[model samples]
Target: MSPLIDCLLIGLGATLIMDLWGLVRHPLLGMPLPSYYLVGRWLGHMPKGQFRHQAIAKASPVPGETLIGWLAHYLIGVSFAALLLLITGSKWLTSPSLTPALAVGLVTVLAPFLLMQPGMGAGIAASRLPNPGQARLHSLITHGVFGLGLYLSALGLRLFN
Candidate 1:
């Protein structure tokens, strides 16, 4: 596969794995699924020059925000995968090392910490949340899972090869 295609698959797969963790975590730990719609809503407002929200939920509803959110979620996942590829190179995609994948996943958490969470009014690193430390912990774990997914996805591709 082309490097672009590989990056896309790796990203989508890792994001899906993180999402699965979100689903299972809800039942196992009583946490709620991530509201990507809020992300969409945030993005939706950006065209109007709004970059941050005091409370994204209270922000006006945007048309197709749900679809936008889901699409953005997957796209962001793919972007992170691209970042991983940039760091590890496509050659690594062939062998699929867990360390590189996991490291990328862990580093990807910075997006939410520095950008997404704060933009959505959750505060940096979810500091605005009632339990900021717990929220941070969950975010870290989810990103780690995403990293694992990157390695797993590459392995899956190798199986087909």
Candidate 2:
């Protein structure tokens, strides 16, 4: 398969794995599942020149925000995969190593720590949340899982090929 196709598969696979982790964690740990609708709501307002929200949960709801958030989630995953391929080269696709994939996954936490969280009003690295430490830990673990997922997905794809 082409590099683009490989990236898509790996990215989507990794994202799906992360989502599954959330599903399992929610019931087991009493953690609430993320509402992508909020993400969509945040993104939906971008065109209107709105970027930061004191509390995204309290922000005005947007039509089709759910679909928008979900789509954006997958697209971001795919983009990450492409980024990994770009950084490590397409040769990694055939070989499918764990180190690079995991590294990229871990590094992706910066998006939420610096950009997403603050934009959604959670503050930097969720510092403004009630339990900032716990939230940060969860983000770290989730991103780590995403990194593992990247390696696992790459391995699976390599095996199939």
Candidate 3:
């Protein structure tokens, strides 16, 4: 496969794996993990008192927004794969090293710290969350899983290659 295509696959596969895991685990923890459309519906149904505060969370990201977010997620994955290709060439994709993958995966910090948190009105990086420490920790773990997914997928591709 072409290098760009390989990168795209790597990213998409990683995201799906992580998201699937979320679906399985979130319910066990009593959290409602809904699709973007569900989120929109829930927001519409929110009590009037909390509506202002949760406007962003309630407002389902439009299809365009969802598409853009997914594309960004994929691009982020592709970028990591591309980096691996540059560093280790064909061998990297076949058995991409965890060190680089983890390092590159750190970029996920941007999502919560900047875009998502602010949009949700939680302040930068969720500094304003009720339990900032726990929230930040959760974000870290989630992103860490994504990073691991990238590393493992790269290893799989390496073996396949």
Candidate 4:
């Protein structure tokens, strides 16, 4: 398969695994998972406001919009994986060290912390949440899972190759 195709599948797969695990472990339904699939819906319906807090709440995407968000989210993941593949090439995907995957995963935080958060009005690192500390911690954990997903997906790809 083409690298892009491979990356797309890998991204979706990783997301599913991590998300399912989250559902089973902590079933907060909307609050925690927020139907990640609706990332685009959330982005699309985002209320226009200068204030970060207001904007995020205004962009409150519903379950109906989740499909778009999920697609967008996975696409981003695939893009991330493809970048890694390009950097290291196929060899890396097949037998990548956790270092690179983990690095990429961890570094991925910038987008949410900076753009997404502020745009959504949650403030950086979720400073706008009811409990900023817990929200930040939760985000950290999820992103950490994403990093692990990268590493595990690489291992799986390696096996296939």
Candidate 5:
């Protein structure tokens, strides 16, 4: 298969795993499922020069924000997978290992810590959250799972070849 096709499969597989984790975590732990609609709303406002919000929850809803956010979520997942391939080179995709996948996944947490969280008014690393430590821990774990997803997905793809 072409590298691009491989990457897409790997990315989609990894994102699916992460989403599955969310589904399992929500009902069991009472953790709310991530609202992609809010993400869409946030992105929708970017062209209007509204990047940051005191509280995205209070922000006006945008049309099709749900779809936009979900699309962005998957795209971001794919981009991260591509980043992993870039860092480790295409050779890694053939063999598929754990360390690099986990490293990339853990590293991705910086996006939310610095940009997403702050942009949404949660403060850096979710400092403004009711339970900042817990929230940060959740983010860390979630990203770590994403990393595992990367490895698992790669492994799955390897089986087909």
Candidate 6:
């Protein structure tokens, strides 16, 4: 398969795995599922020149915000997969490694820490959160899982060859 196709599949697969982790964590760990709707709401305001929010949930609702959020979530995943491929080269897709995947996964957390969370009014690295350390831990673990997904998805795709 072409590298582009590989990236698309890898990104989607990785994102799905992360979502599954969220599902499992909820019942087992008592963490609530992430609200992508808030992500959408934050993006929805982009056109209006609004990047940061005191509280995204309090922001005016955007039409189809939930759908927008979900799409963005997947697109972001795909983009991150592309980043991994870029860093390791397209050839890496044929023989994935855990170290690179984990590195990329952990690095992806910066987006939420520096951009997404702050845009949604959560502060840098969720410093504004009631329990910032726990939140950071959750984000770290989630991103790590995403990295694993990247490696696993590549391996799975190889099976089709």
The lDDT leader among the candidates is: 6
- Provide the RMSD of all predictions against the true structure, rounded to 1 decimal: 0.8, 0.8, 6.1, 3.6, 0.8, 0.6
Instruction: Judging by TM-score, tell me the better candidate of 3 and 4.
Output: 4
- Residue-level lDDT of model 5, residues 138-159, one tens digit each, is 8998899999999999999989
Q: Pick out the ten consecutive residues of candidate 2 with the lowest summed lDDT.
A: 30-39
**Which regions of candidate 1 deviate over 4 angstroms?**
none
Poorly placed runs, candidate 6 (over 4 Å) = none
Error of 3 at 108 (Å): 1.6
The estimated TM-scores of all candidates read 0.97, 0.97, 0.69, 0.78, 0.97, 0.98
- For residues 35-102, what per-residue lDDT tens digits would candidate 2 score against the true structure? 58888999998999999999998999999999999999989988988889999998888788889989
- Give the least accurate 10-residue stretch of model 1, judged by summed lDDT: 33-42
Clashes by residue pair, model 5: none
> lDDT of each prediction vs. the true structure?
0.91, 0.92, 0.63, 0.68, 0.92, 0.95
Per-residue lDDT of model 3, residues 65-150, tens digit only: 55555555556656665765566676667557787767666666676588556656677877877888877776676677677777
The reply for model 3, stretches above 4 Å from the true place, is 34-54, 58-91
lDDT of 4: 0.68
RMSD of 6: 0.6
Candidate 5: list runs displaced more than 4 Å: none
Q: Which residue pairs does candidate 6 place in steric collision?
A: none
For every model in order, what is the number of clashing pairs? Answer: 0, 0, 2, 11, 0, 0
- Please give, for residues 31-140, the per-residue lDDT of candidate 4 as tens digits: 45446633564555644433344554455555556676777777777777776677667776556787876677777777788877766667777777788887766677
lDDT of 6 at 128: 97
**Native-referenced Cα lDDT, model 5:** 0.92
